[model samples]
Target chain A: MGSSSAPWKQLLLSSIEANSHLKHHSYFQLATVSSNNRPSNRTVVFRGFQDDGDKILINTDTRTRKINDLKHCPFTEICWYFMESWEQFRISGVVDVIDGTTPDPLKLEQREKSWFASSLRSRVQYVGASPGLPAVASEQSSQSPSLDPSIGPVAAFCLLLFDPHQVDYLNLKSNERLVFTSIASDSGKKLWTSQKVNP
Target chain B: MGSSSAPWKQLLLSSIEANSHLKHHSYFQLATVSSNNRPSNRTVVFRGFQDDGDKILINTDTRTRKINDLKHCPFTEICWYFMESWEQFRISGVVDVIDGTTPDPLKLEQREKSWFASSLRSRVQYVGASPGLPAVASEQSSQSPSLDPSIGPVAAFCLLLFDPHQVDYLNLKSNERLVFTSIASDSGKKLWTSQKVNP
Candidate 1:
């Protein structure tokens, strides 16, 4: 099976299950490129891991500049550094943006689920000007700023699926560094090719 | 002077001087782009501000991938997020790499100064694998790792000068977000054009 063959995948799975370092700090630094090739990065909350650790989940406001950047330049590197363990995972992947207004029922469910998970204050941010607009002193909206999930940007909070191309797991605590690239088996099942890389 | 007209520059200067929230947390997240436009990011320790806040400094190994990336794509956006104050500063700029091997006395002085400030363990990192090299179990080195200012990658430890193009300051505590752009003044003096950007 895909799960058994990949040692790197198992390591990531165990870390997620342990949840010591990753639970409290789900915010990973997300990097994206502008049209002119300038690198822009900011913090993004990790939603969850998908496909037995084959893919990762993150949500974004459809109006945010990063979502726009992803459309133009789809490749991104999301890095999560664990302070306690001193481990850093550099996951390089291409993204699939599940548009908020999509007619597909499966993606629609994801948007609704993401909205419910988001805090009232976070939901309020998406309904406002698309993220990077020039600031106004205080954006006064009579929209009541309700905590109700239905009242937020139910249509603007999009789902971004990060499908990994490669994962570089570095144990700064130790001298071991591993790189894993996803490949396929003879039977056409997806698997990983793991190797110890120079850190 | 360029410093007087720019309140944003003053704000950054004061923050650095006050050193409350930013003191121990000087590691700002650095984002860079590859030739193929894939965005990669990592955390970089802020060395200091230069040119009256027009430029900032950070030191890194010349053999690292980031320095290589900068050589091809000079534009970079550095982000410093103050967790305690709920303030974020996004600094976008080009880089000027001061090679450690420079014979110039002024450039050599910076390398020497930076070396003195670096910890013994940090100096060890420069001598190992040039960073990002595929790991070979435990890297065995017979040469004793020393804290001497002349030792390690003094030749490989490059000073990266980030010359600002623009700076976007956002206060999550308040709704105020401002973007400042660099411009030349009437007398060929470099100044900034401050604006109230939408947040």
Candidate 2:
């Protein structure tokens, strides 16, 4: 069974709804360990869940350093805070990068769909100069030509599928915390166990 | 030289001030690597800068898992987002844990001052059950006695000093990004170099 059947998904969905008013609610920090064993973190906009599963969707430029870090070590932690409710969800998982060269048919389709789901403005960013490179003065002033949405995700547009193994949910308002862990069952199914803990 | 003298400090301060109206601006996400090599992340309240330096101050219970992670690996990354300005500051640093057992007199003094700086309600949490433990019904309902403010930090109260070496500042509103790196001079002074990068 996919993580959609996981027990923590409901609580996560509810928390998202609770903080829907805030535009930044969908933004979260993703942490990964570089090859040198140093921790790196940055903010990424939540693209949405993949096919009703608990796997998170995050879009990024393939040229970014995080892509290289993920190649070295797929393990990652996502820290998402819901300001209105003062709730935090720390999800620990391994990320799978689905880029232009992805071989999986299903993943490629998902990546293509995600490309079209993005706003034209967001898609424009992928066609521009590579992220983290020194900005070119001439390119900065030039108007970005609109991307052909039908062409699918640009080479630079990469989709990260975060497959979570653990979710630590903390609600400050209730002064409660719960940890949900995913376990593989004898039938090769995914099962989640949750325990209430002190916040 | 302290991180306060770094060039990125000014931009960080301005972003913090721009979002001062939002109470949650003081909250940031901290990422660390566990001994097992997996990345761990959580939201941490920003206490303040240490003295006139950019050593970031954060408080946590000694019983928390983060303390163990720090003991195993001091390297950490702090991701702070300012919603109003649509800016993000990713700081890479090594963390110093200062608890009651700390031998450094000056470090212990800072920890004591940090303890007193916390609100009475916050101090009461240190006297309660250890965090991340299963909640006990009786213990959860009982009223927590006020902690003595005069007494120094409780054994559980720990201070974390984050000494930053690199800062990545991204401003989405202006579509600009800058990287600040700390370089040590031959005379032992810390100097910062910044480069404008594509967002």
Candidate 3:
């Protein structure tokens, strides 16, 4: 929403660009608090940003347990490690779940866009049996579910917008750490501030 | 504590063995709830297991914020991803902090053992300025702190014993997932059970 890019966003974008060669660099760990207050962590793929803002985009299946976890507690943290650069970014944010059940039209359109953005192979998984269930004998084989990509997002396809308020960036190679925090401004917009700290 | 190794432990050991070539294979993300009930996560090195038990060992500096988070909420989750094997393990457990103030002699011995097990280079960081603090001009240089390894753990060194009660193992290549849970037995022992689930 600001004219200039946030300092943390610039650093994060540079880190991502530096490690673009590694295929697995797109994967990061997401931590969420369950209803019982227990923490749950899992690996999730980075889909990109939301509307050129600090909101991080992610795609998930509606049937996954993390979806329920988000419902109970929207606060989450993303721990992304760039092996090549030896850097780690721990982004803490609130997740806005944009699923088929969402009431907002713009959010639903974003969900549809994200659904089509995914590769066909990745999209087919949403149509299969729900995650964490006992594998059905017939669906055990390497079979792809027939689906028309033009039909837009299926019911199970979901999108997550992680609106980050704090980012803890640590570069192991340089032994430097910086924390970026977003503060609500007078105009209802967020302002970012960064401080250098010992790693 | 049992005659046979737990199923999840065996699977995790196999994954570690398979990815031993990767230098970062020992690194994993630890997520803990802060005092404010927000989730915070960061990467930590996996020291080893505790005395052939399921308790995972990790060393950290007491000056780090994670130490305070663990104090507020002992429950944490360890998310480990083996890139080569494309396997992920999510371990949820309660952390038992073995710091300098702990009273038990056996736990203090374990903490001391963990201290000696860490490399000299790793141990020196604890003796320096606290993490996430403004870097002092004097300590900003490449000077190494002088310390005798024989002296054992410093006051800043802390040991965390993650006693996992549940593990979620996912193999991307095989499209399979398994949930391992530990239940308390009649004799005050823990028994593990594994169930196959969809990825």
Go through the candidates in order and give each one's C-alpha lDDT: 0.72, 0.90, 0.89
lDDT of 3 by residue, A85-175 (tens): 9999999999999999899999999998888889988988888888998777787775767777677898898999999899999999978
Each prediction's TM-score against the native? 0.84, 0.96, 0.96
Clashing pairs in 3: none
Model 2 stretches with alpha carbons more than 4 Å out = A1-4, B1-4
**Structural RMSD, model 1:** 3.6
Given the true complex, what DockQ would model 2 score?
0.85
Docking category for candidate 2? high
* Residue B14 Cα positional deviation in candidate 2, in Å, after optimal superposition: 1.3
> Which candidate number would show the highest DockQ if scored against the true structure?
2
- Interface Cα RMSD in Å, per prediction: 2.9, 0.9, 1.0
Q: How accurate is candidate 3 locally (lDDT)?
A: 0.89
Q: Is 2 or 3 the stronger prediction by DockQ?
A: 2
lDDT at A109, model 1: 74
lDDT of 2 by residue, B1-199 (tens): 3443778888888988999998699999999999899899999999989888878999999999999999999999999999989999999999999999999999999998999899988998999898999988998888876777777789999999999999999998888899999878888767888888888
Query: Tens-digit lDDT track for model 1 on B69-161?
Result: 898898888877665565678888888788766678776776666666777777766666646666555554445355555564456778888
Pick the winner on lDDT between candidates 1 and 3: 3
What does candidate 1 score on TM? Answer: 0.84
